[model samples]
Target: ILAGYYILGFSIYSSILLAGLFASQTLIAYPIVNKLGIARDKAVTIAVGGTVITDTLALLLLTVIVGMATGNVDDTFWWRLGISVLVCILIIVVLFPIIAHWFFKLCSDNVSQYIFVLAMVFLGAFLAQLAGLEPIIGAFLSGLALNRLIPKTSPLMNRIEFVGNAIFIPFFLIGVGMLIDYRAFFRDWESLEVAAVMIALITVAKFIAAWLTQKSFRLSKDQRTVIFGLSSAHVAATLAAVMVGYNVILGHTPDGEPIRLLSESVLNGTILMILATCIVSTFATQRGAHNIAVKNALQTNDEEKSRPEEHILIPVANEQSVDELVGLSATIKRAKEPNGLYALHAIDNRVDDPNMEKRARKLLDGAAKTAAAGDLYLQQLLRYDVNIANAIVSTVRERNITDIVLGMHQRTPGSTALPAIPGIPGIPGTSGPGIGKMVTDVLSQSNVTTFIYSPAQPLSTIKRHLVIVPPGAEKEAGFQMWLQRIRQLARNTGAKVAFFASDATLQHIRPRRERKAPANIGFVPFDRWDDLPSLEHDLRDDDCLWFVMSRRDRVSYHPAMSRIPGYLEQVFAGYSAVLVYPVQAGATDRYL
Candidate 1:
């Protein structure tokens, strides 16, 4: 408003409407950032956030201006607008997310889900019209509502973005472009002057906003440039405001013609401004994204050079569990470390039949196929050994595998459930001497982290993680690594992690998580590990359980560790559960 009044010498009403046009920005250059694989960076995030908040306010402001221009500025109109907007927001913000989650959970068809999401967008716009607001406003709110339900890296999100960029967005851009009259810039000086002014005002205003944010927050120069680039594009709401103003006739001219809220020259100027800002935003975003990607690559290389590469081993035996096991390993391994994943199928030599080795080798093929489906590299290992646990332990030693994901079978009380390493000989346990002994042998002997997993459902179906952090879990060497893996799992699954730990343990976890944690993760104080039995009430069908246990020697280990297997056999049989035994930090000595 200030720019329009002081610089353009406009009336108060026109100034307010024009200012609203510039306040909102469209994500015109988001494709550039996404293409460069830096869409998840901090700079791009803040820019997207600013766009959502500013556009909502600007759209409402435009609505008000249009309402007044239509001669509906009475007290009743104001009250109606307030009540309708409130109702609209409540319906979309409160109910839309709930409905979306329910739909996604119950339906797994990809085509159906895509159709549903598109329908929601249109439905939201229709709902906004019912509330007497612009349909565009409701569409924006729908996106913000369902944003968290879809992970950026997931296939569903990729499909959504693909269709949008490929068809919908391009078609919309073409429609908007057709509104621009090329002859006006060449033939009319007034149109040219107005375009130049609008372009200058938007560019300068957005740059200043980005600059002030960078200075206040102490961000990098490239990040500041990224923020400016993303926020500078004057589209969507800009077009809406300008078109609304141009269409709404306020009075009659002395010449017996209509006096629109915005003149023809201004409308032409707004489109020209859109063209100029999008061009600039594209180039700026490209440059900024490139520089940021380069810096991240360098930093990651440095860190990887300093530490051992993260490697995870998955042992697959059950044909039905092959995909589940590979999925768990993918969750734990870093995205960059593709070569570190290995799937082993151990043959029991005691069976004596040559066909036993063939069957064992066939399981590894299923693991390979499962890994390939996810675009991951899994080096398959078919080892002939007397004990499956021995084969896993030997492979870890030879390959320097840092983490082991061992799958477990369903068990009833006093039943030997794990058939993968079935009938293995080891120290006697309460769950009999089969799966329990094999699990104990692997955990008792291996210095590296080992994950005992029994998946009752698909990983994508998981909604929440109920993690039990033993009192001294933070003292373990793999605490940071395991916690990071859990965080990654939460991100990929779109599930929140709830940490149940003592105050002292939370103190350690909070700082580590603060460095690079998802916003959805929460901490709860639970000092007594004995209260684990009470977890039956908290176990939902969609919840995954994580028990952070330790080896026999550490300060983190407790008598409760010995009973976890029995609890899984009885109390938590049907639920997805993982018993994580993390390795000590730098203790060169072996446990056994």
Candidate 2:
């Protein structure tokens, strides 16, 4: 802003004052970046990191400008400023994190964490003011200090975002709106002219900065747009600079007469620019994020994408089966991807048992240890909710899980009985309570591919994999995704895949094998879809059964399919079995 004004032949004081005002932007678009899931992207991170530097330097520059104009530019002034800034940095960057970590470790209660962080924010603000800099600078440094301690997916981070976006930020924006007196603009056209000129300068300068950054970083066009959008909005910092200039410096005339340095028109115009830039930033970020997501999804092949990341979630209920489930997930997971397995323990919120959380955490810890023993990375997700299935579904969506591995559940003695008439076509008397309910709910409600495994023997003892594709399973939306997973598993285990499918389904499987070239995949033709029951003859103690089933109402669903739950209990009770749900059709939006 200062450069623009100076280039336009404005007075030195006017240029410096404009520069300070421009430096104080509200960063109202940060929530938009978070929502887009690109908050960690390089462009967005650079823009955010740049804010701390820009605001700190601008505030320091404001002091210099004021000192020079007021005839206070002396050795004493420089010494005071230098000492104050160094002191503030030492406190914020060096001491704050150490204190925050100790307090967080001492406090397990979430409310205390919230209060502690809030208190620290105010403390930072106070310290910055004392150091002859804007409080926002201190606040920024405090956040940077604590960033590594708070994981983005943690509950504390969610709480912080919720409070800022849902409460304080909205109020701040409202106050900005109230500052804009439309009467001033209506009374003076000069206000409109000032607004136009300032807006043009800020917007153009921001674009150039973003453009240069993108060229240097080799960022995508959409990323460039995001950077420009995020940098354009001026709110909190801008207002602080403007109000200070208006009252302390710009308010005085050349003859030393007291007057408003920023006239009503100029103030009104600045407010209008804020509104305009905020709107632009919001839309631009949304569009750019959508584009990035689409680009990721539209890659020609899984291999073409940056080493495909696999988020495999194993929801553990029993400590007995934790190792088997974790092992299965690690074995089948894409080796090239960077992410690892997530162990989830969802306890019902209605349970009054005080030990539920502790118990859940223990089970998750066991699962994590199991993964670590195998040299695999694992994340723990412990959720307490009224509906266990609903909680798992939410986790799947939030974590962008590609596959779900669950232990096969059996009906409990006190569980509700299956509906006599059944709710949907295909299966009859197939439902049960406890683990069966959890599995059924997730399979029906979620879009991700799921694997329900019940081991009769240890998974390590398995000799062969038998994959059964019922009738129209090939027509399902996620058939390819599940097929690829089967291939990956077969490839990893060095086990030959024996695929049994109807003749029509075989047609699709052949081309996929040729295209994807899945290791050890061989198709066995079954003339009739109705003869799926006959596969029991080929089943053996050494063979793991893979039943590829569609959810109710999907293309491959069968009326007798409702009998699956009962059939497993009656015939395959002591055998290891895996029930797979392919990705649903027309559900690409959640693919990432």
Candidate 3:
């Protein structure tokens, strides 16, 4: 407002509009930081939070200014504005998700989904009009809604990002060019003066804001620079403010001319300011990004030195489940490790079926293809042994495998495998029928960490994880190892975890959770293993159930764990579930 009134002697409403334009900023240099992989740094996140606040305030100012220009500014206007905001938020956040989920659940076509998303974007704009807000903000809110339903790794998200970066951003720049009048700047000294003062004022204002944020938050110089760089480019919303102000005419001039809120020179000057700020912002962001990337590299190198080498072995039995099991391993496996995943299919030499060898080869082939898609190398190891479980145990010892991913009970053709059978009275769900003995034998004979997966839905679609950690789980030999693995899963999938464990166990887990993730992880004090069936109300289709089970002879073992197989096969059969069997002391590599 000071810059406007001093430089051009603008009216109160005109000064207010110009100030509003300066208040809003677009993240034009965000790709620089994101490309460097430091976009998640604390400094960048702080800038993002600030952007949310400033943009909202800037748009609010625009609305109020429009109302004032139309002679509608009063207490009733303020009350209506507040109520309208509440109604808009309710419809967008609460109702949009339910309707979209229903539509996505019903429609499987990719093209149709894309069209539906576009339709919703416009629908949000229409609603925003009724709320006295702009369409740009409505589109922004709609995109935010989509973020919750679709993950970063999803194909649909990739397409949306591709089109936006390719088409929308370029067209936006073209629109900016259309708004700028180069001839006006060359002819009128006023346009050049406005551009110079506006550029200086905005740059100083944004830098001061960032510097204050840094001092208040105790942030570093490089972080402050990043915040300033990301917040300097006043492009999209600023242009909106300029155009809106120019169109609002409150009176007429002496010579039968319309007295506009802002002259055309100011509009031309803003374009020049946009160009100057964008260039400066890019260089600043790049410098900050490089510094942060070097620091992250050093930290990662130090961490890799302390962590042991990870070689995961996934024993394949069911051909259909090969992709799911391998995908699970990929999520936990370190990105820097190559040839870390091995898919082993043990041939039962005792059986004389001619088709068994071909089936095993097909299973390994499928697992290899799935691993390749995730940029992982799958070492296919085929072993012929009389006992399948013994074959698996032997492979673990020979390969020095620290972890194993196995399918639950080697699913029978027509077996539902429900627990508490009439004939099988003692812990009936622990073993169902044919392949149950093999799974039990592998667990008893090998002490390596085993993950028995029973998936009902696709792994990518899981939005949350329910982890049931046993009471004495913190005492297990592989406690730290499994904790690190779960943290890695949390990072890769971006899924929130709700851990249900005893107070003692939660105390131990909380410290590590804070240091590693520190967000999206909740601790629930729960130790009633007997009342596991009470979790029916909390289960969702997009939830993954994790049971940190224990070996029967281990310190964390409980009798209620015997109900897991039954729950997976009967009760929680419709949910994606994983039973984790951590490696126990003095029990690993038993055969070796």
Candidate 4:
């Protein structure tokens, strides 16, 4: 019996056809609204409202069908049915005032509209059950009452309505479809006639309602016509009604035998009607909306064909060297193309230096002037007391920055002079706050696009250099962007690209392969440090080696591997003869 019920339930509740119908209706409604001079929001509201009525109609139809199917119509004589309805009405009247008052109090702040709507729906269902009426009738009345109580613009109201449309409505449609055996309609001609009758009745009822509502509202002829067109749409509620009618109201067959009162054919026919009506309503409304929108667009006065694109903010830290700052500013200017630029500078209060603010302003002024010279609109701002990185990130989000071009200086230990290894406290030869590390860390947390300007050999002078190492898994994002830039730079300079991947990363290498280098690019896969000699031999003809450093310690051959002095010395010695290109700090680093 449970299995039988499950099968029956599944047949009545399936809603794939209903979903398809709704989708089709939405498509059709778009153009109609555009034609009707209705705003997009209004058009959507109308379409949704039209679709919603289907639910109520389905409930009403189901109630009637169930009575007939169960032979309960005879049991509940006309007088008793009338009394039941009166009792239901009485329950509603007694409960509505209390419910409305409670809802108003609960939603006084206008933040609990969703909760209120849900409360009312459930309350209605419960009350209807107590009054021996269909729960859906109560649900519908609850929705209607809540809709009247809640202001249209209330966020809570909008949220609740959206939830219903997204969740409950779809589930209800699917439930309706599952209850019906679609195949039965094909076998029974009577099912088609029943469906046709239902469709006619629904259409006539909606038409009458639309006409009456328009007359009462004193709407214009066009408005009435549009409303009428929109009112024809039906889906979710209709399906739910059909399900209840078939499964609950019209009792299923006894002893697994077919019952004439609530046949599978009726359910199938209803599903088909839902699909057809939805399609018709959608197309009609969309065509109307589209035509209206196009007409409005055409009527608008002619203006400038192209307006200047709005500027996007790009934050710059004051700590950058003059040359590094200039290069980044230049890059931003070039990338702006037709759009203007806004350069923001944040003054970190943590910096105790008295001259810090003045210095930051000076740097920003110079950068702005440089950017402006390249036809980029540049604006500068100075914010106080906040962390430099946090401030920059906040400014990017608040001001809607498009991209960030940051100049990150590598912190090396020891001597400021050339070739002197800067000693770091924890690691040998690395000292101070590493700007590259900070920038990369920031990049991981940021949504804004970042371009780290590291020093490298000048593009003009560099010839036939290999983009050393395929991108390691750890540094895929940074490496890919770097490779693409290098590829472009190589194209301009007429240079070659060489890619190398560690043996562990060999399988991960794509776009570039090991050993067999492309005409313009070369790939080498190596594991042992000793293999560098052979790789060097292959690249001996190349003028320069562009070593793409992985950000992570695993693939990074620097400070992490510094502890293994012998291995480091061997790897360093392997490229001793070649112009070794470490990740450059600025354009000068590239040129030098």
The estimated TM-scores of all candidates read 0.80, 0.54, 0.82, 0.38
Over 244-332, each residue of candidate 1 has an lDDT whose tens digit, in order, gives 88988888989989888898888999988999999999988888889999998886787657657777899887887777778788766
Position 12, candidate 2: lDDT: 67
Question: How far out, in Å, is residue 279 in model 4?
Answer: 1.2
Q: Write the per-residue lDDT of candidate 3 for residues 129-224, one digit (tens) a residue.
A: 799887777776787775666544334555677778999899999989888778896786998898898899999999999999999989888898
**What tens digits encode model 2's per-residue C-alpha lDDT throughout 412-511?**
6776666543443433376334237677677667788889888766554455788878888877878878877876676555556788888888888775
The number of the candidate with the highest TM-score is 3
RMSD of each: 5.5, 16.9, 4.5, 26.7
On a 0 to 1 TM-score scale, where does candidate 1 land against the true structure? Answer: 0.80
Query: How many backbone collisions does model 2 have?
Result: 11
How well does candidate 2 match the true structure, expressed as C-alpha RMSD? 16.9
Off by over 4 Å in 3: 35-37, 70-80, 103-116, 247-259, 308-427, 431-449, 457-463, 512-517, 534-542, 570-573, 585-592
Question: Model 3 TM-score?
Answer: 0.82
**lDDT value for candidate 1?**
0.79
lDDT (CA) per prediction: 0.79, 0.73, 0.80, 0.48
Give the TM-score ranking, best first. Answer: 3, 1, 2, 4
lDDT of 4 by residue, 100-165 (tens): 656554343334545666776888888766655558667766765544344222234446756766
